[model samples]
Target: MGGSGFLGGELVRRSVMDGRVVAATYLSRPGAAAGADWLPLDVRDRTAVAALIGEFGPDIVVNAAFRQSDWVTTAMGAAHVAVATSENGGRLVHVSSDAVFSGKAVTYTENCVPDPITPYGAAKAAAETAVQAIDPTAVIARTSLIVGDGGSPHEDLVRSLATGGRNGVLFTDDVRCPVHVRDLSAALLELANSDRAGIHHVAGADAVSRYELGCLIARRDGFDPARLPFGRRADTDLPGPVDVRLDCGLTQRHLRTRLRGAREFVK
Candidate 1:
C-alpha cells in the first residue's frame, strides 16, 4: 500500500488478512498499525519513493499517497508512483473520486468523460490521467464520499455537524453515494487480485443527500434531527457539481466485494 490513510489503512489490514506481503508507508504515524512493515517516506521525494518501490518489489502497486495542500502534490504524486512502477512491470491500482465528473446533472458511469471543477477533483482527475497514460491496466477506482468507523470524510463532516454551535448545519439537496471504507478496501483488494482492468465505478448501493445523512447520524447518536443545521448543496462555496452519483454497474458485475450505502454506518 502506498499510504495508510483512511482507506489505505483498511486496505493494508485486508491485504495482510489475505496473506499478502504488505509494505505500508505513512507521513507521520508510520507505526500506527502492526500488520505491515511501516516505512516512513514522504511521497514528495521521488528518489525515496523510487527506492522504496525498488526495495519492496511489490507485484502490484497501489498509488494511494495523497495530499490536499497543493495541486502538484495531489496530482503529480500519482505520476511519481506510476514512474516508480513503470520499470517494475507492476499493475498500478489508483484510487480516484466521483469529483472527477462535473456533477452536472449526470450519473457518471465507467465510460463518462472526466470533467472536474474543484482543485481536489482536478488533482484526482489528473492522477487518473497519469495512471491511464502510464499503464492502461491500472485500476482506477472512482468512488464518492467515503464513510466508516475511523478517520474519513464522513467522520470530519459529522464532527463539524455535531459541534456546529446551536444550528448544526447540513445540506438536504446535494447527493452522493458513500461507500464504506471496509467495502472499498475489499473491492480494491479483489480488483488487485483479479485480471479486471480499466476504470470501474465502485460505489454504494444507493445515493443520499448530505442532509439526510446528517439527519441519520444525528438521530442515531441522540441528536435532534430538527436541531441539526440544514441547508442546500449550493450553500457551500464548493464549485459546480451538486450531485455526482456514480454508476457502479460494472463493479457490481465484476468485483467480489459488496459495496453498500452510507446508512450502513449510522448505528
Candidate 2:
C-alpha cells in the first residue's frame, strides 16, 4: 500500500519493472508511476481494508501506509491490514521503523523489543505488535531513515537549508542509519518472495548524525556543505531518540540486495 510516498513510489516502480501485476493504494491522489492499478484506500477503515484485500486477493501484500502523528492510521490501521491480509491468505510484508527503540542501547538487533519514547515510536511499536500477533508468518521489516537521490524528506530539507529556502539546524547529536530507498524497496520485495518471517532489521551500514547526513547530501547536490547549519539535539527538548541504529547483520546475510549506507549513496 501507500504507493505515492517516496519509499512506496519506489516499491511501485520496481514492482512494475519486474513485470508483476501491481495494485498500489493511495490516500490523497494517485502516484505518477504508471502501469499499476491505483486504488484509494484508508487503512483506518477496517471494512474497507478487508473488502479491498479480499477483492484483490494478492499473493503478497506490502503494508507501507502510515501517518506518524495519527495513532489510528499507524497502529490500528496496521491491525486492520494484518487481519485483512490474514483472511485473504496472502503473504504480508509490513514496513516498520527504528523509532520503536528508545536509543538507550544505541544499536539494536532484530530480537530487540521496542522501547519507544515518543508517540510516533509507540505507534510504530504497536503496529509491529499487531502485525506479529495477527500474522505470525508475516515479514515485519524495521528500517531506519530512508534517503533517496533527491526525493526523500531529509534530502529536501538539506536542499532547502543550503539554498536559504528554509530555516533549520541539522542536529549533530541525532544519529541514525539511513538506507537508500531503492535498496530498501528491493530488500523488502526479496523478503516478500522468500519464506523469511518475523522481525527483520534492514538498515544502512554506516551510522551518522543528521548534520553529517545533511553535509553529505549538500556535497552530492552541488551545494556548499558549509552553508548547512548544524546544532545538537541534546540542546532541545525534542521528544525522540537521539541515537538509534538498527543492526541488519543477521537479515543482510539472506538478502542478495545490498543495503547501501547514506555515506556511499549520497556520495
Best by lDDT: 2
- Candidate 1: residue 218 lDDT (0-100): 70
Which 10 successive residues of model 2 have the least lDDT summed?
A: 258-267
lDDT per model vs. reference: 0.79, 0.95
**Per-residue alpha-carbon lDDT of model 1 for 121-217, expressed as tens digits?**
8898898988889878788888887777646766666656676744445667788998888888888878987998889898897788888877776
Q: In candidate 2, which residue pairs clash? A: none
lDDT of 2 by residue, 1-267 (tens): 888989899999999999999999999999989899999999999999999999999999999999988999999999999999999899999999999999999999999989999999999999999999999999999999999889999999999999999998999999999999999999999999999999999999999999999999999999999999999989998789999999999999999999888888888
lDDT value for model 2: 0.95
Output the TM-score of candidate 1.
0.92
Clashes of 1: 4
Task: Tell me the lDDT of candidate 1.
Answer: 0.79
Off by over 4 Å in 1: 163-168
**What is candidate 1's CA lDDT for residue 178?**
82
